[model samples]
Target: MLINETIITDIKNIIAHSKDKAIKAVDHQRTLMYWHIGERIFEEEQKGKDRADYGTFLIKYLSEQLQPEFGSGFSIRQINLYRQFYRTFTNVHTLYAQLSWSQYKLLLSVNSQDKREFYIAETIKNNWTVRQLERQIHTSLYERLLLSNDKESVLAVAKKEKLPSDAKEIIKDPMFLEFLGLKKESAYYERDLESAIITHLQEFLLELGNGFSFVARQKRIHIEGDEFFVDLVFYNRILQCFVIIEIKTHKLTHQDIGQLQMYVNYYDRTEKLPHENSTIGILFCADKNDAVVKFTLPENQKQIIASQYELYLPTEQQLMAELNKELENFEERDKPKKEIQ
Candidate 1:
């Protein structure tokens, strides 16, 4: 008697799937167990509120007994983390079974409820792995998004309360490319940067934001026997438009903006379907003068965007400094109008 290869393959797949499910089930149960333990600790602490060190003593003593039976998983540090997890996620109903203990641990570090909620929503929607979620948090994705958009708009889109109406809603400015393994001190050509992007394309797409899918590299366009090459091209499903990016290792100039605009026009005229929105052009540069970008494109221009790229991840303080600077600039811009009114 012989068995078919397909039948064996199917049985193997079933076994693999079941094993995965079983692992997930055990992880979820462990999460629940920790939550219940945390809840009990909290209740006990409340009863001993008069003693300042009662909560500390409670966790310390509990860990001593539990560690002897259950090993390091019940260590003092682990027990404290479980307690924090329970307090942070008071409503077990909101705890997603899909998220593992590691993912929840990362979320617990986020201080802001709104920011934590945003990461939670994004983690679920994007099906991000723990590493990916950690990278987003380290890169300050929330702060970068808020650089161009209001907090409400950023969170609303993350939570699916509203669909993104424009590329700016989802696209990040001052994009980080540290994952490309390029040193900040090293100078490279545009082609080098483009190659690095393609090499680490997955990380690039993640950094690109929500719905972008790569379309081409050095896409060629012909106009009256003249040849033009787009550095990189992508389609953003959320905005429903083709996004053309031109990389500039140097500071952005009006010429760079004009060149990007030409590529955008070419895409809109030839590549874009009638049902699709107009093409978007982005000058992915190392640096840019905002005034130059403002005056180069039309005042009402929505199709062209100039974004700076950073070789390294910025610290929270650095992002906050940039945010504060932007706010000051906004205030300066509005002062004249207020005086007139």
Candidate 2:
């Protein structure tokens, strides 16, 4: 009387798809409902000539009458949100069906329309949850992306219209890992930090930028009787290359850079296929002296990169300061080369 395994598997897939579809349908209906409500409210407000004081009374009256029968979700705060949601989005045709009401609410809070649209594009492409949406906004991800890229490229990447050509397009120098729940002041080993990243792997991937897929942790390599373990390994589909990450909890040195270069070479010689691009190495450290990094690697190097990790998200002022410092260092590095030529 047992069911066939093939039949059972097919039934499970069907049910899973059905559940996902049902949830999506419910979300779409809710978003549309709010949009329609906002449209009605807007039309009603026009009778009062869009007067702010009349609009306030309208929302207040509606909230009081709606609360008893409809529920607390129709409170004054939520009513205001609904009005703002429609006002922000404006056209019904532009509403994203895939986004939830909560996601839209978060997007509406962003003041810059360009930034808001970029977040929307990213959220839709990444299938991010409401919490992820909130975290990205709070971290000022839009501003950070602007630090390296232009406004057009940032929007283009979020919309998946263009792929990242080099690491600079996707790599954030000071990676924000505040979501990992690790303290910057705490004394910890490299292994401890690696473990935290592995545990929060999803958040880690999001922080890693785009097209990265985790392949291994403590990846082991062997040559004759010797063994070496890499901290992390990932593949970037967009770059068509393997990305090797080495974790160092202290300041980076020439030796650390050399070690990472060797790892990249190992992957190129052994692990990489002829059709694939050269492997890239990322040396993740707590502190990086630009002088050490510049002098350690080949001046023409493209496959090696050094980036610092931060445990906390910085304020706008702090982020701007860091951006200015990075710009200054780049100019300094370019100055000597300009003089030589």
Candidate 3:
């Protein structure tokens, strides 16, 4: 009576899968328990609204009793957080099975409803882990996207309500490269920066924006005996185009734009299929003058974009400054139209 190895292996796999599902079920149950507790606390607090300190008194008393036998999760702070969580996410139906309690805790900190909704949609769509969500939030991904696009458009793309029609809708400007571990003061060559991006390719892709897949690096092209190499090439599934990037570790100039435009042209003429959209070119430079970029390209040209790169995640002050600058630019651009009207 010999035992079959295949049967034993199958049983082991089944047990492992069952354990995983059971763990998920228990986590979800715990989440539901917290929600119920929060719901009860809110209801109780509402009834005692005559007294100003009633809510505080109720939570403190509950924590004292619950913490002894039910464990530390019912501490005063935890109870308050649970109440806040309920208030933030009023509808339990909107709570996703994929999101854990830890992830919800992070989402609760997002003050803007629209921003939180966008994060929720992205987290579910991308299957982001707790750490990934935290990183995106910490790096101010939502605010960065808003700098280049309107709020509605950004939310629409994240929620999959609409597919991106143009690169600007998805690609972020002043792209953060803190994950590359490059020093802001370091004198990096073009090759050095390109190598850093390749080394942290996955994080770079996340920073690049949605639907970008790596195609090649230092891609060589020959044009009538002239040879050129593109620093990085990517294909965006959402926009249905090839994105060619040229790295410049110095202030961008008209010549840099011209060089990137040539790469874009080459890809459009020789590589892009008829059904696909035009090839997009990006001049990823250390610094750029917006006036120079605006004047360098043709008025009707939309394929070429010049974006600055940042070596580190921006502080809140830096983000606020960028937002203010964008607002000022918008106002200035609208002034002429307002006068005409």
Candidate 4:
């Protein structure tokens, strides 16, 4: 009887594994099939004198014929998407099998091929879901990269074989925390935001970009009979270090920086393994005094970063204004200081 029970368990495991493999194989095949269909539709559209009109008609006719047989996957809109998909990704071989058709549809909407490729590569490398990919794209990940890095470095980081050391290298400042669903003038406390993040930890991690995994929330540490609580703790596998997040509902202050530095120091000395890199502390504040941030840290500080957090996604105009401000600040900072006699 025991032998029979063991055999049954083994059979069930085999069946589950087989089902998973089969599902993956089907998904892969479906992606390839869609790519091929897209290629064919694109070629036909190119040949048509009135390509736009003809493409619309083709998609409509195809949807009518295929929807009943293939169900929701073959709607007219999706057919149109497939056509655009081919146009966007002419090099079908580069399509990552891990990405679903939904992700490809989102990728198709991005105007820049380089930007699309970057998102695609990152999505595959990080194993981002369709929703996560959409969120990142909507957040203007490409634009953020442009703001933070040179063109060459941006491309390199996007296509690199490995992730970088700093979260700021990938994480966008003024992070869109609208997902927390906090009202702008709600007078919500820091603990409220922290609680939301903990509740939506998975989404938060996705927004945090790649290599982050939850370690703890409100993690307690005792040093020399003094007790302290860290708001959020995460491990970045790529950076090989602990990431300590301190939340502030108000503008950042030098005291906040000092507190975070202490947390980082504690983590580095006690929590971190010998093989791991130094701990990184991030202050997520509703506002940041740039001058305060600049002077509060050492000249070459890399471990601690003070970034503003926004309750909602900024509009294009707001982003542009911020960019202009940053540019002006850069110009001011770079202007040669008058030689002191």
Writing each residue's lDDT as its tens digit, candidate 4 over 70-177 gives 999899877877777777778878877677877877887788877887887788777787888888888777766565555556666778854575556776676777
Look at candidate 4 and tell me the lDDT of residue 211: 79
lDDT of 4: 0.82
Ranking 1 against 3 by lDDT, winner: 1
Displacement of the residue 336 alpha carbon in candidate 1, Å? 7.4
Q: Against the hidden reference, what TM-scores do the models get? A: 0.94, 0.86, 0.92, 0.82
- How accurate locally, in lDDT, is each candidate? 0.90, 0.87, 0.89, 0.82
lDDT string for model 1 (2-47, tens) is: 7677998999999999999999899999999999999999999999
| Winner by TM-score | 1
Give per-residue CA lDDT, model 3, range 192-296, as digits (tens): 999999999988888897789999999999999998899999999989999999999999999999899889989999999999999999999999998899898
Candidate 3 residue 229 Cα shift, in angstroms, is 0.7
For model 4 the TM-score comes to 0.82
How many collisions between residues are there in candidate 1?
0
List candidate 2 stretches off by more than 4 Å: 50-52, 222-227, 314-341
Among residues 3 or more apart in sequence or in different chains, the pairs in candidate 4 whose N, CA or C atoms overlap within 3 Å are: none
lDDT of 1 at 119: 98
